[model samples]
Target: MTTIELTAEEMAFAGKIGFYRDYENKQRSNIADYDTKRFNLTSLQAHRLGVMCEVAVGKFLGLDMLKQPPEVWTGFVVSEHYEFNKGPDILNRFEVRRANVRTSPIPLRKKDLEYSAQVVQVYVPYTQTADGISVPTQCELLGWSDSVEDWPKAETPSWSKNGQARVVHNKRPMSDLEVMV
Candidate 1:
């Protein structure tokens, strides 16, 4: 497997973009807007991971992340009149999903299946410095899949605060994904 590592400069740049975008979301969201972000993460954390993963994938796809601004994924539309849009994660062609080295099923929320092309998986592993601060120094592009249409539908691994189970449109296995070059 090929390993992808971001440089110190890339790290700083990604963090800056993530912070500003997260801040923008907070400022723009009104009470009527319901946050669709899952996984118990604050909006800031999600934005950071989202940006870094997309950058890493772009690098894997032969793009210079530094020379280009990261594209923000506009998720499900909040307005009643507007329909959902295909939010591609990179180059308007792929959707990126965060995974781990151990491998697990890639879960896509029911509304997230509007992506136009392949579902690409990326695993970002962290390392601890001598000072004991954890930093991401390793990333792996596990695989890609366009056959999510055949994947099994299931409930989210987590339950809501009220104990209602949310649905995941595709819970596709990691091992089943096609290996990336």
Candidate 2:
């Protein structure tokens, strides 16, 4: 397994802080039907969070982000469309997830299995206090499993929570990961 180190400041500056701020501003704006403003906001937040994790993970691995296609960029990769690659787009490619028990199962459909990555990395972010203050803390690499078979089974149905679909499973604690920071 490959590991990389990241300082607190670097992690803090990567992804979604500003986007969320803008979102909050919109929430308070005097617009028609403001109650529906939260529409699709959660999914957007999740997507942004995933991108943030990918940025950190890619940086930690010492890979050049400029050379990689944006997470949603369309193009060819390994004989297939780049969008075909799900999860984290790092080193050997991985599916990134925030630390949550319900999200442990990797969703690899039968057809998607061929295009799926072998690693599943979960990142637990440091908390931001309500006082508008956040203690600088390193995002934890909760755990990873290299077993492709461990990904969610295609035939097994997934569950939904907060309007998001998730494959649930009991994952073993993160293995001994060696990070060279």
Candidate 3:
């Protein structure tokens, strides 16, 4: 398991970006009408994790995330073609998903998989805060899944409060990912 550790400043910056984006999305009413995300986190928490994980994935692969954070969706409709950056986006493409280090499958919803060529599963090493946000100084690069669109999936129970989620199994180990370039 490859580990990418963020500095205090990186974590704080990620938190700020996540909160700011959520605030902007709400201000513009870009918050979706239907969110099929598997986790129980508030939009703010989710966004924080999303941005932080993406940044970590980039570091794990020795790539660079966008120097500037992404702009808010111009319109309320964030369709497959119009969705924001999913992850590090190596030529093969990737979307980072958070899961428990012990037992969590990659969270690959149908719509989310469409835009991603691969799924990168990440796990934060520390316990989440009571306030429901967990910004990790170190993230475990558990592994990844290529051709995940065809992976077997069923509603499976998890440590998440939302319980069962339809997800991909048998992701390749992180060792396989490093040579993927």
Candidate 4:
């Protein structure tokens, strides 16, 4: 049996900030031309933006099936000062000080596993809209592998000559964003 621990980190820099909201079915087509006013984002609001981005990407990559709700967690603190560009027009730029993954659990069978390693990831904010909506368009995941010298090695399974019975069960987590509306 082997145990594995995974970790991740995500960050966004030089991104534009704006206020945004979902468009109703009736107004979907007109959303692009709709007026989107900018506003100062609260600490919690900014944090949620990071979180939603993480969740969106995870769901896209099939990772949503791997973990429970709060599947991808995030903790963020906003920088004190907002960077505004004034040359052409006023633009708001706020930094999410430090946002990193706390824990990511990987479930696997204990047997047939030699050793496991930790996985770390970082996500950066890349795009923001005039509607105060932000999304992390860039993300990176790092996986480290190392040998466990002290643990006794288990015998390898021989599936070549012997007839074996195997049963596999797969389960997927329900999407959270789907129910938010």
Write one digit per residue (lDDT tens) for candidate 1, span 1-181: 4577888877776777678667766757522213344334567666666677777777777777777533433321223212332456555566777763426455444334544356666766654356533547566766665624533444445533332223334444445544352
lDDT of each: 0.56, 0.42, 0.59, 0.26
Query: Which parts of model 2 have CA positions greater than 4 angstroms off?
Result: 1-9, 16-48, 66-88, 101-112, 131-137, 152-181
**Model 3 lDDT at residue 65:** 52
Q: For every model in order, what is the number of clashing pairs? A: 0, 1, 0, 12
Model 3 agreement with the true structure over 33-80: per-residue lDDT tens digits: 225354556778766776677678866766545453233211112233
**What is the lDDT for 96 in model 3?**
67
Residue runs of model 4 more than 4 Å from their true location after superposition? 1-41, 53-61, 65-119, 127-133, 136-138, 142-181
List, residue by residue over 134-156, the lDDT tens digit for candidate 4.
54444432221111211133222
The TM-score of candidate 3 is: 0.65
- Among the numbered candidates, top TM-score falls to 3
My TM-score estimates for the predictions, one after another, are 0.61, 0.47, 0.65, 0.23
Off by over 4 Å in 3: 27-40, 66-92, 128-134, 152-166, 178-181
Alpha-carbon deviation at 164 in model 1, angstroms: 14
lDDT of 4: 0.26
